[model samples]
Target: MPPPRQSIAHLAERQFGVVTTGQLLTLGVEPSWIKRQVRHGPWNRLHRGVLVVHSGPVEWRTHAQAALLHAGRGAVLSHRAAGYQHGFLDSPPRVVDVSVPHARHVAGSPGVVLHRRRHLGAEGWAHLVNRLPTTCRPDTVLDLLTLARSDDDVISLLCAAVRARTLPAEIRDAVMRSPRMAHRRLVLEILEDVEGGAESALERRYRRDVERRHRLPRAQRQVQHRLGDGRRVRADAVYDGLGVRVELDGEVAHPGGRTDQDTWRDNAVLLERGDVTLRYRWRHVRVTPCSTAAQVVAALRSRGWRGTPRPCSADCPVT
Candidate 1:
């Protein structure tokens, strides 16, 4: 039979190089033996009762596993940690976030954020990803809502999730399931905007402050076009009932200058279809929204749209 040390190492391999003292003891490894390894050998203590089984390097997974084990059984990764684990977050978290049953009290550890969940046992929202127990993706989004420092932070997370291909229905259903969610309305509104193909805050700003506020006709989103060279492209927004298409250029896409692809789509798709499009950036939508709305109304009028654009307020200049 393999020795207790070998047994613990085997178990740690399955846990991203994390091993709990209870696990070592269960394998018949004495406390003194564990001490010797931590004191003078390859292992390093991550928390009070958790240790890294190897000495090469401790990555995010290792830290995550150590946090989970340190929090004991029935704990799962949550919030930003789960976001990173679920492949939506761009970077590893500075502090590992772990969620445990509200009734369970795990001692606080350095570099770990503990979230107590009331329904973590029979109705717990957890599953395995990359071999570590974590909150479900939608639930992770909800957890993030509670922890986000600002509205922009929340929006950034949701946009990142959308970019990572998380279904809107899934997040919406999660919101529905959580009736008492703190940011429910804001999240739902943003989700609707994003699902309507407003991929950036700039696009959403146009949809809200410019189009809706000015009473412009509802525009189709992500309108796809098949070009001459068989290249399929999608426009940002298109007015179907009226012959107007607006191409939103956000900051993230080619920040320095416009792409040739945009020109090709504009000429081949918009002009050929006899649709007028407006090009606007962050400043136009955010700084001079009324002027932007006025331009859109003029474009719509050029396309034979017999609609009057309303000023957003008494002081507004949309007309």
Candidate 2:
């Protein structure tokens, strides 16, 4: 090797910089060396001392930069940033949020959102160690709930949170103890309605929108018609002898890594119950109740059960 790699830049190509003053000194790169590098366009200064080596695609460090700039010295990225890292949100947040322990609120910047919590639980908060835009899952869930626009939005966020087993008990407690949350009757109802697990919420939402809205008869959830110890496949919704079974189709229901797996499962359910099964989607349940009801009624009529969905204010808006 040529002279045994003398400097920090020589050691790492895309360096996030030395973690401390001591590391910088150990690397024999003084404050002058950093300044000279930046001045010569060898490194980009992200914060006071954190320098990133100029390289191909230095990553979208919006959150880390905001955290470093907003929280001053020792703030590691957490909450929404962490959520992003953990793959919770589908899109990156427009504003980078930083959590500082102090009570001072820094004036806002164009893309910086600073949060000061007096006491964020340190136990679970250590997940962000050495990670940019990192946050504990609990805090992330709470932030999503606070920021989500609609009940469906909240449901979507919570469903993900629940699936990840990251929805904290503290969040549940915070919702229950808050007097203000009581005013949001729909949110409260949805929150209370979340039982069993994330799959349960998906099932419940499908039942509420598809079965209850269309005046379809209630189908027993997770019913197993199979005999003892034989890995009974649970029907999502079972009408028993009423000639209808509603199979709530979620992503987990299809496991072959193919869309055809879903079709096969639906067909299997239908064939098992003499083709009386009605399948519904997770997202379109609320919005497409009319079409879903029409399908169910058509199925019922084919089985010699005459019934029509009553026209109501719930008639879907023409889209």
Candidate 3:
């Protein structure tokens, strides 16, 4: 067998250069030796019982490992931390979120958020990422929605996941089946809208604030059309009977240059077919929905829509 020092080094390498005092003791290293190494050697203390083998610049994974070690047994990375680990988040987690069994009494630390779960060890609740235990992607998304501060944040996260094709169908089903989850009703409603083809937060806002709120006729979302050159194109929203199309120009949907050209080409094709297309940007849809509704109403009326536009509320300007 290799020496105890070699064994410890190998273990630390596997764990993002983090090792616990208990792990060192289990490797047959003397307590005095471990203390001396931490005090005088390259090892740096991260938590009460956890030490990083390197004193140099630490990576994001090192922070995760240290938080997991400090959280003790039966704990898994969760929430934003799990989102980051699973590539759902654009940036590294600011604070580590760890879920421990309800029976365990792990206290909260400076850089760690502790969540107690009654059935954390149940099958399918947790999985491994880079050798570290973490909540499943679906659970992480739900947890994030619960922890979200505003409806816009929740919608943004859901839209990001959907745009990246990382939001699985099972996650939506799970949320629907879970009746006791916090914000369950709101999440289910959003999931229903998403399933109905609101692929981005901007599209969802248009559907809600501009269409439903103003009492405008419902338009088909993501309607595909065949161009003169036989190229297939999907319009953001289409009113078939009225021959009117509403396009939400979200940044993710119409990334500049090539996509812009494609959008212009699609608009020309629709216009040639006697369709009226109204294109709106993020600011137009989100910041000024009343004005957007007015424009859509005018387009729909010109295309023979007889339904009168009504204000969403007494204060709404759509009327």
Model 2: lDDT of residue 7? 64
Question: Which candidate model has the greater TM-score, 1 or 2?
Answer: 1
Each candidate structure's TM-score, on Cα atoms with residue i matched to residue i, is 0.81, 0.72, 0.83
- Per-residue alpha-carbon lDDT of model 2 for 1-319, expressed as tens digits? 2212356555443224323333456666556665676788556554454456563444546335534554564454655665666666655666667776665555555455677766644556635433453556656666656677666667766666665665545457556645464224554555555554335456767767766766776667766664333434556776656667776665554433336754665566566656466666655566566677667667666676655555445544311
The order by descending lDDT is 1, 3, 2
- Residue pairs with clashing backbones, model 3: none
**How well is each residue in 204-286 modelled by candidate 3, as lDDT tens digits?**
88988898889999999999878777877678899988988877777755656236676675567666677877888888888
Could you tell which candidate, 2 or 3, scores higher by lDDT? 3
Model 2: pairs clashing at backbone N, Cα or C within 3 Å: 78-134, 79-135, 81-133, 82-133, 82-134, 82-135
State each model's CA lDDT, in order.
Answer: 0.83, 0.57, 0.83
Candidate 1 shows a clash count of 0
Better of 1 and 3 by TM-score: 3
Q: Which pairs of residues collide in model 1?
A: none
Give lDDT tens digits, candidate 1, residues 184-249.
888998998787677877777788888888998878877887766787878778888676777777
Worst 10-residue stretch by lDDT in candidate 2?
13-22
Candidate 3: give its CA RMSD in angstroms.
3.3
